[model samples]
Target: MATIFTRIINREIPGHIIAEDDRFIAILDINPLVMGHTLVIPKEEVDYIFDLDEKTLGDLMLFAQKVGLAVEQAVPCLRIGISVIGLEVPHTHVHLIPMNSMGDINFSRPKMNPSGDELSAMAEKIRSFL
Candidate 1:
């Protein structure tokens, strides 16, 4: 079965897309920690980010950086925090979170349950800055 990220990449599941390339896709997190929070995933379904080849891992960071910059510009935050906590889902993924402080990126904190309209609006704002 395709992983959830793969389904989003393949359009089998709807995602608030922020950016995409031949190898990667960036989309808004529905249960976001903050506005402009997004996930960057390789099109390939690798289970662990560290398991990716050096070149591919390097490419993913560069790709995520570009998306992160746009998120920073579009959202109110001190910085964009990059995190790789792959326990929730099997797929390798990077979380590009908009953070005002270190605590903003804490996974233990309750996630924001934004409506679909809010997600769409946030996605557009991030895309506009990209």
Candidate 2:
């Protein structure tokens, strides 16, 4: 079965995409930790981040860096925090979270439930910077 991220990448399900290239895709986290929390994922569905080959891992960070810059600009934040907790979903992904304080990246904290319109607007704002 395709993972949810794969489904989104394949356009089998809807996603608020922020950016994409031939190898990777950036999309808004539906259950966001902050206003501009986004996920950077490779087109290939690898189950673990460490399991990716050297070149793919390096490319993934470069891709995430580009997306992070846009997320930082689109959303007000002191900096963008990166996290790689892959337990929630099987596919490898990088979380680019806009952070004003330490608590902003706390996964233990409850996630924000923004409306669809809010996510769409945020996605547009991020795409504008990319």
Candidate 3:
């Protein structure tokens, strides 16, 4: 079965996409930790990040770096924090979170419930930086 990230990559479900290349896609997290929180995922849908081939892993980071730069430009933050806690979903994903303080990227903290419109607007803002 296709993972939810694959569905989003294929447009099977709605996603607030910020950017995409032939290999990876960047989209806003629906239950975001912060305003510009984004997920960078490989279209191939490997179950674990470490399981990915060396080239793919390198490409993924490069892709995330591109998105992270845009997120920093579009969102107010001291820096973009990267995380790889692939427990909630089956597919490999990198979380690019905007952070001004240490708690900003805490997964233990409750996520923000932004409306779809809010997500879409945030997506557009991030895309504008790319």
Candidate 4:
């Protein structure tokens, strides 16, 4: 079965995509920790981050860095925080969260439920910077 991220990449489901290239995609987290929380993932569906091949892993970070910089510019934050907690979904993903404080990246904190319009607007804002 295709993971949800793969489904998004294939256009099988809706995703508020910020950016993409031949190898990777950056999308808004539907349930975000902050307004610009984005997930950077390779198009290839590897279950674990560490399990990815050396080149793919390196490329993924570079891709994430680009997305992170855009997110930082698009959203108001002190800096973008990177997190790689892959347990929620099987596919390997890095979270690029806009942070104002230490608590901004706390996974245990309740997530913000932004409306579809809000997500779309945020996606557009981030894409503008990319």
Candidate 5:
């Protein structure tokens, strides 16, 4: 079965895409910790980030670097923080979250509720940075 991320990449599900290339995809997180929170995922459906092959792993990070730079350019943040906790979805992924402090990256903290329109606008803003 395709993971949700793969489904999103395949257009079986809706996603506010920030950027994409042959190896990876970037999209807005629906339940974001912050407004510009994005997920970077590999095209191959590897369940664990650590389990990815060396080449793919390196490629994923390089792809994420570009997305992170765009997130920084488009969003107001001290920096873009990356987290790779694979438990949320079986597919390996990285969370490129916009943060002003360490507290902004805490998953246990309450997530912000951004409207659909707000998400759409933010997605476009980030896309423009791409």
Candidate 6:
């Protein structure tokens, strides 16, 4: 079975995509920790981040670096916080969250339920900077 991220990358499921290259895609998290929270994932459905080849792993972070810079420009926050607790989804992903404080990246906290419209707007905002 294809993972949800693959479904999104293939357009089998909807995703508010911020940026993507041939190897990876960055999209807004539907249930976000913060307004500009995004997930960066490889096109291949690898179950673990470390399991990726060194080149893919390095490329993933480089891709993420570009997205993180754009997210910082597009969103209002002290800085972008990165986390890789890959438990929520089977696909390996890096979370880029807008953070004004330490608690902003806390995964245990309740997630925000932003409307689809809100997510779409935010995605476009991030893309503008890309």
If scored against the real structure, what TM-score would every candidate get? 0.97, 0.98, 0.98, 0.98, 0.96, 0.98
Model 6: per-residue Cα lDDT over 1-130, one tens digit each: 9989999999999999999999999999999989999999999999999999999999999999999999999999999999998887899999999999999999999999999999999999999999
> Candidate 3 regions off by >4 Å?
none
Q: What does candidate 5 score in Cα RMSD to the true structure?
A: 0.9
After superposition, candidate 6 runs with Cα above 4 Å error: none
lDDT of 4 at 86: 96
* Reference-based lDDT, residue 121, model 1: 91
Q: On a 0 to 1 TM-score scale, where does candidate 6 land against the true structure?
A: 0.98
Residue lDDT tens for model 2, 12-57:
9999999999999999999999999999999999999999999999
Reference-based lDDT, each prediction: 0.92, 0.96, 0.96, 0.96, 0.93, 0.96
In model 2, where is the ten-residue run with the lowest total lDDT? Answer: 68-77
Task: Give candidate 2 misplaced runs (Cα > 4 Å).
Answer: none
- Decoy 2 TM-score against native: 0.98
lDDT of 1 by residue, 7-74 (tens): 99888989999999999999998898887889999999999999999999999999999999999999
Candidate 1 similarity to native, TM-score: 0.97
What is the total number of backbone clashes in candidate 6? 0
Q: What is the per-residue lDDT of model 4 for residues 65-118, given as tens digits with 9 covering 90 to 100?
A: 999999999998999999999998899999999999999999999999999999
Q: How far is candidate 4 from the true structure (C-alpha RMSD, Å)?
A: 0.6
Q: At residue 121, what lDDT does model 5 achieve?
A: 97
Ten-residue region with minimum lDDT total, candidate 5: 110-119
